[model samples]
Target chain A: MNLEIILHAGLATGTVLLFASIGELLAERSGILNLGVEGMMLIGAMTGFSMALATGNPWLGLLLAMLAAGVLSLAHGVVTISFQADQVVSGLALTFLGTGLALVLGNGLTGQNAPLIPNYDIAGLAAIPFIGPVFFEDHSPLVYLGYIFTPLVWFYIEKTRPGMHLRAVGEKPVAADTMGVSVYRLRYFYVFVGGCLAGLAGATISLSVSPGWYSAQTTSGQGWIAIGLVIFAQWNPLRAALGAYLFGALRRAILDLQGPRMILGFVNPLYINPNLGFFLQMAPYLLTILALVIGSRAAMRKRIGAPAALGEPYIRGERGL
Target chain B: MAFPISIAIEKRTADVPRWMPAATSIGSVVAAFIVSGIVLWLIGSDPVRVYGFFVRATFGSWAAISDTMVKATPLILVGLACTVAFKMKLWNIGAEGQFYMGAFFASLVVLVPLVPAGTPAIVVIPFMAAMGMLGGAIWGFFPGFLKARFQVNEIITTLMLNYVAILWNNFWIFDRWSDAGFQMTPTFERNAWLPRLSDLAREYPIFSGITLHLGVVFGLLAAVVVWWVLERSRWGYEIRLIGDNPHAARYAGINIARNIILVMMFSGALAGLAGMSEVSGVVHRLQERISPGYGFTGIIVAWLAKLNPFGVVLVSILFGALIVAGREVQPSGIAQMIQGFVLFAVISSDVLLRYKVRLVRTRADQNAAGEAA
Candidate 1:
């Protein structure tokens, strides 16, 4: 019941969501929205769990997870890029199909155990002793990707040429296309990359944190949280990471604060219900709504920030998304 | 594949050209079966044999027919739910949640003396069913209100509310609703369960082993009522106009936001009725895991039916076959994989069904109007 352990678990949860969110932000910024992250993440988690256990190799598990997700993401690219189906519904359907496929394919691996990736320290960083153990020492290697992606994503979107072009599509796909940028091609690349990151997030759950277990609800609503975080961060990766960690801490705190001996009366009602932990589980959703309400204009200022054709598919020779 | 609920979809709804429908139907079936076949083969199963099992499991016997009906009942009802609200462009994605809520309401009626204890089973069932509808209606209205008042996206709100409803219903059945016995499925009084159709017992032969409750009749009747509402009513015209061209409809004097709220409420009520029927017919009580993601799957059914109520009945049964047959697939894993593939194929075909993918043949199709038409 230590608060720190609870906080660490929450951080792990946030990291899973953060990996996916950062990738999605990259894709959405470039004016291509991918809603299949949930499905991809589920596949990743299942694949990661099975592979890690199957080969007793955590590295392979993470690799397979990413590959699985990356491959599944191709479907989204095909539908949106080639056929011009509405991205919103297509994404929704893809997620369902992906998750269902993962569950069905993963039947033999249920109740299995997974090997945890060994922890490592930054050179000379382990010398910090107490702080390192809590913040760095004992976590899986993939957990660090959460931190790396935040800043890496930030630079890629802000400093890279293709990143700039990607943003241009969101601002004006027609303009980007006129500039000789192939919208479909750019969208496919970003979506595939984003999907791999989502896969990594899922593997982080199975191989790094919960290790080896997979359920249809295993990924739960973290993918949705990533969607919310994109808005909460105002689509900034660095800010998204912060928001994810803070939310993760909140989730952990709820459980840490709960014990059979803990008194309920006189506590805040939101934290007082026996099912407070369960309801608090909906923190990401409530946060999304709250962020939207607080930054209503910020959300609508899509012309300056969001993808020009975020939920609209790109059909060549068509008028618009 | 195809989006079932676009404004452009309805205008082009003339019965597809004779050759196109037949070709597309064959294409889609072949495409679905092939994809499922390939996936099954990877897992070391024969696609041909698995598909045969799927077909037989779904249609080969009377038990299969009734079982498929049982599975399709709520889906049909919920499909009708999505059709009604979707007409106004109100996406009520929370039907699964609403269905669970309906079961909760019906359970309360069974547990609480909302009516006289000696009430006839017939009277009690309908009354409870109505109460269940109200429960879902209320849940539906909140998002409708938010969308109407603040221009909030109902898709996100409706989807989020689903988990809340599921948790709410789950907590009740797990904690307050059940007795001390470790039963996840609560037992409702005999007075609460709806009676089966008379003809079903007498008319059905030995093969039709599954229960044919009154809910099937309700599901069919719901389709008729919904078809009449959407196709014949003046309000239906408004909904249609809103769906096809909301901006023009509004310019010409349509209460856009108000229509959203009304349509959503009606949709939620119908979905709730679907849930109510399930309780009154089969499950007979509120329990954990009340839905098997039916609300979400029902969206596809609504899409496949082209949001037409009568079409919903047909499509729901088709999807229901997969769900039932999926359970009976000779070797479970491969059967499910094929079943799952069929779903994606069905949805994918709908995409091609709705839109024509032409090469960049001319500049004329560059305008919104040209592409839309």
Candidate 2:
């Protein structure tokens, strides 16, 4: 109910959504809309959990997650970009393949606890008694990465050479091909990098944020939310962070709102019930659909944004149907 | 000049025969199997023994082969659903959701206790399944409508519906999860079960290994019906024309928007029947995890079959063998590797169909003109 609490919840959502959204932004930016992000994230989460438990190292677990996701995502990039298969189908299949692999491999970490990412104090800021804990305490390095990576990502795209190439390949691959840019090379790079970003996002869930082991549905629909985040942010990294935060707040706010209860039945019921809870749990998913629909409207699609060349395969010297 | 030679090469590319693409697909699948065998060997499983066991186990016995056919029924139906819609460039990826919806509605029909004990068994059974098909078709229509009207991506809408269907099922099941009530599944009346063909199988050798329910028969029938529609009907001609080139189809007086919606709905209906058929036939009731991601696998099936209904039958049966074989393999995880490899290759088959990679030589135009290379 209070402003501060709402702000706090928003901050949490931002951290969770930013990781996957930013990765998707990069993938879409290359005109390779990867639907396998969810698959990669789930694998990343499981791998992160296992590595953390086995080695008792949180950072190592995160690294393992990224590696795992990167490898899994290769199939997607190869089939979708190299073979020129339908991007959406390839993405969906990658998800199935990844999900299958994760479940099979995640058997070891089932019901076992893994190492957690701990918050470290800032050198000077932590000593500032009241404001210090509120600002600096209870925040992990992963949160900092989510925040700091935003502007850094924006700069890379708008300012750098390879960044320009990535955007060029995305916007007009044929033009880039005419300019002697290797379209396949650029696509492969972005897809692989996106895989790494997705992996990091997965680790954030299992290693740093939630800080424990979970299986299968562990990543839940965070990957899809990340996809939604891409549309919500209009392919902008900084805006992506804001959108993620908004979603995360929505998620925790519903959980934090079970204070008072209603009768189970229409008439004066015998007991208070969480029957309304199913709708509550579905709030995030519903919100995502609404966001996608609103964002894709022609009047709004360009405004909220989708990558111009998203899902279009680039073929040089030929535009044959 | 070299330019004239280049034109000759391009002409050759255009002249490739129609059956060549399918031949290439089969070649790639075979190549994938050979490579995948190496992966198995590295993982310590004997490829020869494992494959032998897989073949013998899945096709070796009557009961096992029948189980394989049963398993493939839903996959074949869903694959057909995707093939039809996707050919029209309408992606209906929510077959899993539609399948569940079909199951949900069919389950509703099954739960009714009002049917008299002496009522004709044949009448009630088909009616139960019809509701399921209707439910799936309705689900498919909405996304198509949305895509046509609002320019929304059918992919995301269908994907989202998957969860909606899942939650809908959960909402119903939660009510039945209480103690003393059924947990995993509530039993359906004996009358609703698919008529088993175990008896008919003993009398017919070709069908001996198959103990099919009505669903398998319907699946094959549906495929034949779809094949006929796609090949001989006016609508099928329009779909092929639209898929090949919408501009031409429009010039020929085809309604593009209507076909998109129509194709997707029909696609959804078949997929829905797939889900419902399983419940009314094999499972006899809805349970948690009713489908083993059959909707998604339909993509692979469609691709493997090259969108041909008869091909879907062959590929679905092949996949059925894989699934049956996958379970029977010891230390079972290796089967997934085989599946992943096959799917990867099947999807990648499109590449060979579209392109012919050739190594170029910088020889003079005179040499190029005389050589087939």
Candidate 3:
């Protein structure tokens, strides 16, 4: 119920969405709108948990998780990029594939213990005021990594030669192709990168934030939330980080709201009738919808939109977006 | 030395053969089975034995076949739901949510006792069905309205609403309607239940033990109706046009926004009907997890059926078999895995429809041919 604790937990949980949305951002930036983040994340969570259990090394588990999800993303790349299938349908199929694979592989791993990512406090930063305790205090190393990762992604996408090429491929594949950028190769590579990040996000949940596999419930539509965050962030890494943390805090707040029987001198309906917590549980999702509405309106008013060629297949010599 | 051969893919300029699409779909299903078998073998399960058991358990007996049909009934409705929305290029991933809402609404007939006690089946069933559709339609309307008005992505909106809908159902089931604090409501009286073949066991002794319900008839009727709507109706043509080319549809003066809302409602209604059918025809009570991902499975069914209404029915039957057999499968995810493979194969197979692949010899072989000429 404490503000500091909720914010701290939010940072830890937000790291999961941070990695996933950034991954989705990378893929969309390359004009491949992959809706399979949920599937990839689930696969990552399952693989990370099982590998951590089998090898007794959380680091190896993390790497394998990324690789497995990366390989799975390549499936989407082949279908959408090479075969030129409909990206939406292919993405949906990828989710089914990823979820199925994770479920099958993770069948008996439930309730089994695994090595987890360790939490650490920043020495000087932890000693600071409220910001220090909430932001820099004891947290999964992934949370600290997320703090550094967001700015790095922003730099990579907004301030580099490769980033320009990435933008070009997404915005105008024909122009980028004429400039000697291999549109197909770049799309495939970014899609893979996106997959890896989604996997990392999934691993963040299993080995770090929440810890343990709960089958489909392990990722629990957070991957989908990440995709929504991408849209809400309007494809900006820094904005995505902001949205992710805010959503994380909001999710934590929803859970915490059920704890207090009295709020601001009044009784809490949810606390009294625990079943009403179901409605409370829906806050994150409802908020996501609210965020999308706001995001879409902002985009409309500001003329900031999705990548120009997002969701279009880049076939050579084709007349298309 | 360099490789002597290279693979080349060239886009097709002409339409494919009439039978090609169907052939590719069938071929994809076969390929999916082979791939799934490989996966099973990799996991140390004998694919043959598992698949053998699948056939035996799903179609081994009249009873097994009837059970599969029972499963297929809901799928058919949900598949049709997907077909209508997908035809218009609206990815209504929230059919799962819409289905839940539908169940909740339909259950009100018995729980709230909307009708007086002992209402005849003739009056109760249709009213329940209509209420179910109304619930689903309302659930769908929000996303549709948002997408049409604000240009909000319906995919995300619909998906988000799914969680909300499920939780909404949970609140009722776990609180107000819990049968002695159980997670489900008490069983409805016989009048509220859909008439099953077993209901006539006395008059027709041969039909004894059969659980096939009238919901299958609903599924069949829905398919025919959906087929007509998509094929014969002007609105259907408009939906296809909007899906294929929105710009052209707009140029042709089609009201895209209105259609988006309407089609979504229609789609949600079908899915709602599916939920209603499940509660009324099978479970005979309102409960949670009544669907083992039938709403999700319907998406695959629609795609595999190529959005053809009658094709949905056939695909649902196959998936029905998979679900019925999946219960006994050890890994428990084998059916889902197979479905994933099927979708992958089907989409990959679409390449054959759009392009021609050929093996070409390298420069040396070309030079040899030139010399011979």
Assess chain B of each prediction and give its TM-score: 0.84, 0.86, 0.96
Clash list (residue pairs), candidate 2: A13-A248, A14-A245
Number of the top-ranking candidate, with lDDT as the measure: 3
Q: Each model's interface RMSD (Å)? A: 5.0, 4.8, 5.9
**Residues B1-373, model 1: lDDT tens digits:** 1432323322244555656643554466567668767777887878778778777888888777778888899989999999898777677888977887777787778766577677788789888889888878887887888778766667767777787787777666655655674435557777888776533556755534457688888889989998998899988899999988888999979898888888888888888888888877888777677677778778777765667788789878887887787666633334334434544555565555666544443342244423332
Model 3: per-residue Cα lDDT over B26-137, one tens digit each: 9998999999899889988898999999999999999999999999999999999999999999999988999999999999999998999989999999988998898889
- Relative to the real complex, the DockQ score for model 3 comes to 0.56
Q: Tens-digit lDDT track for model 2 on A1-321? A: 344565554565567678888888998999999988888888888888889888999889889899889888888887887667888777876776666667656755767878788876567875676555544556777776766788999999989998898888888887777788888878888888888888888888887766665665678778877886687567888878878888877877676555433423243221244444555676777777677666667436345355567898765446622
Candidate 3, residues A1-321, lDDT tens digits: the string is: 799999998998899999999999999999999999999999999999999999999999999999999999999999998888999989999999999989988989989999998999999999999999999988988899999999998999899999999999999998998999988889999999999999999999999999999999998899999999999999999999999999899889888988988988999888889898898889899999999999999999999989999988876765756
TM-score of 2: 0.87
Q: Predicted candidate 1: what Cα RMSD to the true structure?
A: 5.3
Cα displacement (angstroms), candidate 3, residue B34, comes to 1.2
Best by DockQ: 3
Q: Model 2: what is its DockQ?
A: 0.30
Ranking by TM-score: 3, 1, 2
Task: Looking only at chain A, give the TM-score of model 2 against the true structure.
Answer: 0.89
* lDDT score, candidate 2, position B306: 82
DockQ of each: 0.29, 0.30, 0.56
Model 3: runs farther than 4 Å from truth? Answer: B363-373
